[model samples]
Target: MTLETKSLSKMDFVYWTSLVSGGVAGLVVDIVLFPIDTIKTRLQSERGFIRSGGFRGIYKGLAPAAAGSAPTAALFFCTYDGLKSYLGQFCSKTQQPYVHMISAASAEIVACLIRVPVEIAKQRRQVISLRYSTSLEIWLHALKTEGIRRGLYRGFGTTVMREVPFSFIQFPLWEYFKQNWTAVTGTALTPFTVAICGAIAGGIAAGLTTPLDVAKTRIMLADENVSKLGVSRILHGIYRDQGIKGVFAGFVPRVLWITLGGAIFFGFYDLTARLLSSDQAK
Candidate 1:
């Protein structure tokens, strides 16, 4: 292979490997500690968080959270890798990094398109069954009661708005930080450092996109399925009722979980993939 092609292959090898590893780790986290994710989603929805009925309420939807999240994580990384390859055709030899960024962002956007709907169902089931049973049961109930089209896919448009830019900024930023930060520290990329960078990127992206997320949650939970609720109306309602803070409810857990979880995902994935690819290239 030519030098440029070799380099691109190396980077792509790392990139794809990191993402896939991260997906598996994410699945592990979602399944093992699903209550945290369920609570995070339920709190984001604000349908009933503070009341917390009890431990039962908090852990209401564990099973479905796993089912929904594990597969989505797998699909997300897979789609991201495929799209990056497809988009690579248009990238100049000199702009591989730029192309990488674009590919990662676009992959996330497409993944979000699918994710929002499943997440709506996942979150709704988590919220409604707060007083009841397992996440798996909730999943089946949601499937039965709400069906595929309306219930599961409640906030798809708004979800797109929230996730697209979030991924756009997050993935590239983490990679940039990982390489540079390692160089600066004169050590290999540690999980803690990677986690810190991922956290920073994730926190910024999550905060930046909170307004859209707020609208998405509302649309998902609305009795009428408020896809009709324009972005302006959603913002206006939150502003009028809850004010600016209302628009950003649950910022704490959202930031912390995403950052910590993101660190584990990206750091381990990158380290493992780079090692595997280096051996393969040899």
Candidate 2:
């Protein structure tokens, strides 16, 4: 069913639809592009762009990512759309950009709770030369040795820092593109247009935030005995050690991954949401 745009209540069906659509989109995108993600992670890891492995075990941590992708994306879009609808009542159209920024940042915070642990597992598995057999094994081993907070949720704060600004920049830009596309073309924004906008937004966001991502990855992958380092310290260390380029270690692979992944993700999300709404109307 088509969602009534005027509805601001949390109980509205659109919120749930957004969750389902976002989840399905995320699942599809992560699964299809997971190998690229593996490569990107390896590039970003301490290995520093070395040829770790060819296509031998590219799908190492696909399970944990597949498990978490849906829920994380679902929570993100659900919170985003819900907040936008709720805030729309009080804010003028001129303030919609701020609303989008707030909604995206808030959504990322909630999504990170699920995302960080899965990411820790996924990245560790990706970097390892030896196969872990299953994502469960990696998680269990990490939990047993490093414990939950230090092991699984090690870079939670840095991740949030990376993600919040990423979303803040991305969603507003995505929305702006969508609005302008409609205004300029005098046609409704299609799934293709949404995908294009999402790609542009995701690529820019991912590129600009690579330094924070590098910090987050290093923190998460660090040995437990290593002293804890904040984002600033990690970034400074990267700069001091490898110069300016070290901070953007995985920029190329990451940009490629996020750009294509974002296109596929928002494409499917918009398509699924539109189909669901159409079916409901019928």
Candidate 3:
């Protein structure tokens, strides 16, 4: 008996092409929506009422978010490509993932993986305090104080909780949407169509995960003694203080952000995936 690494190894034209396209999609979304994302995140995570602000206020963390996500995006697509291919090969046609959805979902998981560290840095960057001046500086401070895991990767658990299911639901949904839509319309599934699916999926995921997301934010950003506090207690505290509406605090902004970016990010991602695979075949 012998072991074969290449046999186990996964890399192909479809994967590279999808990855390239997905990577493009990621870059476009972040660049276009960086401002909105920064603000939505801030509003979502902040306490004592959501502060209304101009585009500048909302996008305060754009610089670092952009910085963080540039590398993050590349890694996201690459990981997504590999994971989707592996998953697709093993899973059935219905359960198995396609390149498009896998790309979207994998990109998101990648986003989730780095989210905490980047988020902590982003949060610190926005606040004008003695602690953090920039992403780099904030990182240094976080490294010294809370150490790597606790400070940088604050919301590690919830990140997975949100990303995996969110990606799973979304990727397949998009692929289904593209297939059904293309068949009915007898036209290629355009970028716009893909965007619509991505947006819908993003909203659904966001709505479902907001409570956990809120907890993640509070734990990371809040000064509270996170250890003594349970997620339920914190959520109840929010409900008591701000009411049920407060739980869905950043819903509106988040929906818009996801909608706009999802369209652009995923629309291009699919298109690019097609191109990449074609190039690989050549």
Which candidate has the top score in lDDT?
2
TM-score of each: 0.78, 0.92, 0.81
Better of 1 and 2 by TM-score: 2
lDDT assessment of candidate 3:
0.65
Model 2 off-target regions past 4 Å?
A: 1-11, 130-133
Per-candidate Cα lDDT values, in order, are 0.65, 0.85, 0.65
User: Which is the leading candidate under TM-score?
Assistant: 2
Clashes of 3: 3
TM-score, cand. 2 vs. native: 0.92
Q: Write the per-residue lDDT of candidate 2 for residues 25-131, one digit (tens) a residue.
A: 99999999999888877776766545445455788889899999999999988899888888878999999999999999999999998999999888877876535
Q: Estimate the TM-score for candidate 3.
A: 0.81
lDDT of 1 by residue, 1-282 (tens): 899998788667655674566567666666655566656666656455744332355555455555556556656776666666667678775665676567676666666655765565466656653433544454466567777555556666677677777787787777677768967888776656777787788777777787777677777766654556777798888789888887876676666667666766665555655666777779
Q: Put down candidate 3 lDDT per residue, 48-166, tens digits, no spaces.
A: 33342334454555676766665566677677767766676676877655555666655666676666688777765554332455678777876787777766776666666566666
Q: What TM-score does structure 1 among the candidates reach?
A: 0.78
lDDT of 2: 0.85
Q: For candidate 1, give the lDDT.
A: 0.65
Using lDDT as the measure, name the better of candidate 1 and candidate 2: 2
